[model samples]
Target: MDYIGHIKLVNGQVPSESLLLDEANIAASRRVDLHVQTHDDPVLKLCLWDQAASEFWKKFRASGGTARVVLVTTLNPKRYGVLSLSSMTPSRVFLDGDIQETRDYLGWLSLNQDVANRLNADVVVKPEPATLGELFSYMKRASAKVAWFECTAAIDNVVHGSKWYYIGCGDCHPKATKGPTTLLCRKCGKSEVVGVAQYLAKLSVYDHNDQAFFVLLGDAGEELTGKKAAELVESYYEANDGVGDDDIVPVPQVLIDTIGQTRTFIVKISTHNLDGKTQTLTVTKVLPLEAPAPKVKSGDEVDVELCNEREDLADESVKRAADGVGSEDAKRARCG
Candidate 1:
């Protein structure tokens, strides 16, 4: 039977093949255990003997062990402790060299972190484009298809995660009660107000195949929402003079607009083992996606846009830093 699969693991040749006299028989003596994944099985083992093993090894090395794509033609299904694939004398193996399926498999392998990390670093190749479903599959395993892979996804929805900020006693407690001129910290039993900002955002992003969740930190959230945490709180206060403990604040309008927009992002994917039996993929890092430009335009519009974006970011960074320290004082002044 012929099978199209991606090589997951490759073992060293069996001993005594170099001692054979006949060329064909000597070739048959060389054997390698290959762990491959076919369309039917998520993982399957194949034993390549003699000539097939020798030729496959050369191609695997040439691909720097990253060329995981392969097509095994002419193999027998046999029981060796369990069901496995055995190579025949006439079996032929093709690497990523000329087969389209092999090329597609290479892209698929890029999404598997474990497979990608085990590959030789000298390969220095980028993964092929993949859908959200493919990315999730790669992450579901113990590792990723490739180290430091990127994905392009559309914002399916925005999830409200942590509190925007805590308003409390100016010095004793971050969350406090606001009076006419002074703040009261019930926990600290003091009267002074200070505001501390906490920004944690979670976004559900997807491509055609499926969806996954990503976490965004303060800076990333601010960039996406176009408003600082302090600003969001201030806006809330302006609309309603008093906020109760149970009052729910709405998300910033800017952030709401991000739903359905496409962006590219660098992802750090991992899996966590639970109780030695179950594992789950942890997908993180939500930031603006960046890719190489196809060609430089003759005009300065591209340059201007880049410069403006950078300048805005720089300005926001400085503003947020200042707000972090002075926001409490500003709030006190406004209330006083």
Candidate 2:
């Protein structure tokens, strides 16, 4: 069967052909694993060898890792525990074409940040506690040192600047060109791709004295929405059945329900100016109000001084009342 899809990755250095006969074929085969996501739903892995391998490897290296190609090749579907596809003779390939499927896949690749995140999952430790006001103030201060801040505040409202979800390029996952036959990623300058659904939830949250805009991206957005953007998009299509791809997916009710709710979050504040000012907050983690936090010891100097000051004032007030009562009693005895 002719398998046509995007080349998501091109691995390095082909091993000798003899490695193909050994069990090491799993590791050798000098195989190039092409992560291909279809325009509709499923993402598949395709392996290339021989001429196909040499051509793809050459172009991939030439493009500085941004090269995308569509392959129309006969594939051997093998089931070594899992179903896999490998290139066979009589295969063909296309690069950066005007084909609609190629265009759709490219669009998807450019905006597929979730796909990128899954491909590159690295743990980021949550930051220290702060207020929304403090987060903004930190960004403004010339000597600000912290990179991330943990904050608790009431979500004043969910800002509907446009739609809650955005159609982004699968490759770089940035917002893509709309109303065009092919998706275009401005950053990568690639076209003919599909759009991936991702959350772009902007929230207005505030403490007692101040309010700031906080953005929840990808998993953080999914956490706030209580469902993945892909899941929500799929559900919308299942319900609407024949809706056009250009039609917008409605905001999930779960996301809507977050309004006026209080949640603790770890956010990274942007220090550099964007658009005009530098104070921007991005939520990295959504935690429950009762989430475990480090205990502040009562013996800390600040706490100790506050306790001492309250106790001293209490003692002085009691002594003044006692003296007033004794003087009144002495005056009453003198009068008698």
Candidate 3:
């Protein structure tokens, strides 16, 4: 379906706001939230992600930012506290004369420019900074829906035993399960899929007196560790030449090195947290260490030094091949 509307705003172009979502390799993965006003939908926000986002901005710049009417194709309709349209990989953005609909809409917009002018473009939702306690509290509320928040927390522990990375369908990146012969992706409903390792690392994070689990999904791990999950997995396999397919790689030292560091994370919350299926926060982005961390609210500061239990839990499963902990014998031990 094509969404034709008057483009009210495109994020990252707003002045005095360094609102660049520093979540991904940015250049390759940019996000543009479109404040569009259309017939029947007054405050529709179209989220252009990855390719769609970068290209839209390119065309917007080429047009001297005068392109008012936008025509976006293949948007996935969603409601997350607000009605929103999110673009997928196949989505494309068109503006002004680029498409017949946009051209016609632009002509119509020129006649009723005041209608577009009446819309408040500043209604876009920006991620608010929240503490772990506050985030979980929101989960219990009946009104909680999909939302993003920035949380500054100290790395208390790197979770152990959980699979650090799962073999994902190479095309879509969904986790693939072991099939009769090859890995299968249920989401794609296919067999013999292309399998590639992707990050699914876990960390125990704490802010003030609130502690919560944060799962680094997709490229979030790579952004924090400064190394690709595939590279780390390949290095491990090369070192241990013939490890069994069933044998899982232990948490890499690169991730462990972040144990005591403090970083601000952009976490996304949804029904997964609200329904109590899991309270684990899915980390979408990590702010650079040099950037000032969000201030922990007064009377809620947690002293990690005094939390000896967290340190102990992190070191319990240190990647120790010398002790045969990560060896074939260790793998068998875990099953037993």
Taken over the whole model, the C-alpha lDDT of each candidate is 0.53, 0.56, 0.69
| TM-scores vs. true structure, each candidate | 0.36, 0.45, 0.55
Off by over 4 Å in 3: 1-125, 291-336
Of candidates 3 and 2, the better by TM-score: 3
What TM-score number comes out for model 3?
Answer: 0.55
Q: On residues 1-336, what C-alpha lDDT tens digit does candidate 1 reach at each position?
A: 997776656652211223212335435668767766654344556888888888886676565555656788999985422356889999999987568777787677667656534544222123345566655565555423223345677776655533433443335423456688876666556655564543444466777777666544444556556666668866777888778745756656666667776766554332221112112122223344455455556875453232100111122232333233322221111111
Off by over 4 Å in 2: 1-121, 178-180, 186-190, 241-248, 271-280, 288-336
Model 1 spans with C-alpha error above 4 angstroms? 1-131, 143-149, 160-195, 270-336
Q: Pick the candidate with the highest lDDT.
A: 3
Better of 1 and 3 by lDDT: 3
Clashing pairs in 3: none
Whose TM-score is greatest here? 3
- What ranking of all candidate models by TM-score puts the best one first? 3, 2, 1
